[model samples]
Target: MTELSNIPHALKGLNSVVVHPDFKFPDADVVLSVTGRCLYEKQLLVDTDIRSNHSESGGASTSDDDEDFHSQTSRDRRKEREEKNNPEKPSQATLFKVHKSVLRRASEFFADMFSIPQPSNQDTIDGLPIIYMHDDPIDIHNFINHIYNSDVLHYLPLRQSTFNMMSSIIRLSRKYLLLRLAPAAMFRIRSDWPTTLEEWDKNDLQVVAITRWNAQVRDGSQDGGSRLGPEDLLVEPCRVIRFARQENILEILPAAFYHLSRLSSLNDPHRPRSCIEGRKRAHGYWMGGGRYATRSVLTPADWDTLMIGKAEIRAWFVNFRQYGWQSIHATNCGADDPSSCVLSSQGGWKNYWDEVIGVQTRKILAQDGLDVMEVLQVLRHVVLYDENLCSGCRVQAGKIVGCARTEFWDCLPDFFRLKRPNPWGGIWMEGEPVDCFEQSI
Candidate 1:
């Protein structure tokens, strides 16, 4: 619902994370990848040299290069280059020294593996067991990173690469059934692709997502959008759809569809990434890398909702002029309410066409995309801040806007031609359906 509340004592929160309370996950036992040379092996020899001289004074347990999560981030490429140039760097693979006890607490998968009846026959580098994985080495590394930095609110950096990392963590967390991890992973997911109106109010997350999105799509941005694909945040509603479906996160679909409709403005599937090069770069981006490609991620029913929902929202804006909403007006203007009684002089009855509420409403509708909640914000701000309206009438105006918002929400399913996820009495209908995709994953 909000950013995490943990503050570090170091830079404390920047590029760093707090350890779990039981943070005794010492020595990485999981050997993610074996290298040609012992990266750690070289560092140990240097540390030994430093410590022997100090032994004559007072010996100390010094910090090692391979300490805590082994910043293996970019070192793999560097390690490869070094091995190629100097073929005599002691041919050994990289090793991770991790704690089996900590892995057991975080992952039931590991717990089951450890519980299997066998001689503790696994290989080890430094007394710690080496567990090899068939998963992408990058993903495995990112998952282990979270285990080390699982501090609340201390999230990974908000870069495009981070989004890739997030995708990995979500899948891994769900697969491993990491009970302690679901909340943090899901919170990040919710911030980017919220399903509920309340979650959509997180402006900070929106700003970051949109900024990153704009950089990647129509024409690439100065943003590192090159690394981000259409399936990435710049334009991937399918990503959210698959993730929510996989995780049984049913609530994310509706709001995600809302964002998708707006996103469709930039993403014309027939358009190529080549069109937006150079000068066309600053222009709006279409996140749908391939229209058919993105649509394939959703079930037919979900696809119908998105298509109908988008058209219906645009239709709602057009029909506002002809909708005959006269019955919804309230005229019980309090005796002291000058604004209400005086509007008769300007016009017989107030409407969006009236000079008072004119143009702005149309301006919002005319904007490239229609985000219903955003429209409501514009409407509310106009009504609440109008100096022409009196206190009592302002209160009444707010009531009217509230009523209209409720009405809009209520009719959403009907507008979208959807029977499920309806706002029944302003609440989502329970057990609508999330099994649309019965994937083995």
Candidate 2:
């Protein structure tokens, strides 16, 4: 057992716990410790049907008696094998002891497996039948962890390992056909993505996860500034978008593309969309190894779609600037006078607006692939709550931006070039998981 103090140091998760990657038993990195018991461990690796390691209950008998007993046992075993329709049980079988009732209740696969009439050679330990699994042991451990602890989702802290763990849970849940467990896994995965501007603002962990998924970010690298660069943005969101597309989960794409475009510089044609533009700022490694490298995971079609969406969003900005509403007299409207507020209502507001508000908003909203939360911050900071600007002009500007929002929301699907519009026809909201079994997990 890991000592309580050592757990903080030993809070290990997969560096890249991918979809059942090449694995072996007794690996130091992959382990599960819970409820004072550990599964899928070296000590627990046992061949249930074999008793080579077992000790006799009593002293050894005479050679003649032992020979007679062994011959009789062999004859009984042969008879048992010949009598049943079940395939010959393995002379040696790996064991995982779990509650039969839990398996029966949680999965139809288990229900069916256990439904088979017991073989005479079936093995047991600690009052539980030995249920052998052919899956990667790590996957089995993760899935069983969820079954044992329904509140396990809440226990997951915000960290780089979080997504990888959840991915493992989801894969196993789907494979075993754990219908109830599957949605919960999907829900947590879906929740990692922020749907609204508010959710985006509050979630730094998601950003860290997005950043860490592709490139490893070290501790203390997160400085509260414009430290996030395009290199940080490209790999993770694109992979996620690809995942969503494969899974037929359209809801996750709009925000994903929006973030991707901002990061990829798709909105700004002047800025080159170069992959790995500079010598890597943060030392990191590629998770996808060998024939499929992480850099090439984003398919060509995905690249084209993201670029198109970026161009489309930038085009909207161009249209808005050209025809939506431009202030004619770029000056202050003293109570009664009329003045347009494109940059700002007052002359001073123009300088701050150009340098601070508009520029950052453009980068955050159009160029730098990120969420709108930062842009909203600029808006809140720029919009005057006092008697600095005309009430009528404020209303007009508000109405313009409001209308722009509606237009933007309506066209997000077209922005991302998705084949079919999301069912909500807008940003995905966190709620009941999509009910279609085909697309559920």
| Backbone clash numbers for all candidates listed | 13, 3
User: Under the 3 Å rule for N, CA and C atoms, how many clashes does model 2 have?
Assistant: 3
Q: Tell me the tens digit of each residue's lDDT in model 2 across 352-430.
A: 4355446545544433444343444445445534245466545544444444554454455666666434443444343
- Model 1 residue 225 CA deviation in Å: 10
Model 1: lDDT of residue 179: 72
lDDT of 2: 0.45
Q: After superposition on all CA atoms, what RMSD does each candidate show versus the true structure? A: 12.5, 16.0
Candidate 1 vs. truth: CA RMSD?
12.5
- Where in model 2 is the C-alpha error above 4 Å? 1-97, 122-138, 155-162, 194-235, 264-280, 283-295, 321-373, 385-387, 395-399, 402-406, 426-441
Error of 1 at 120 (Å): 7.2
Clashing pairs in 2: 262-368, 262-369, 263-369
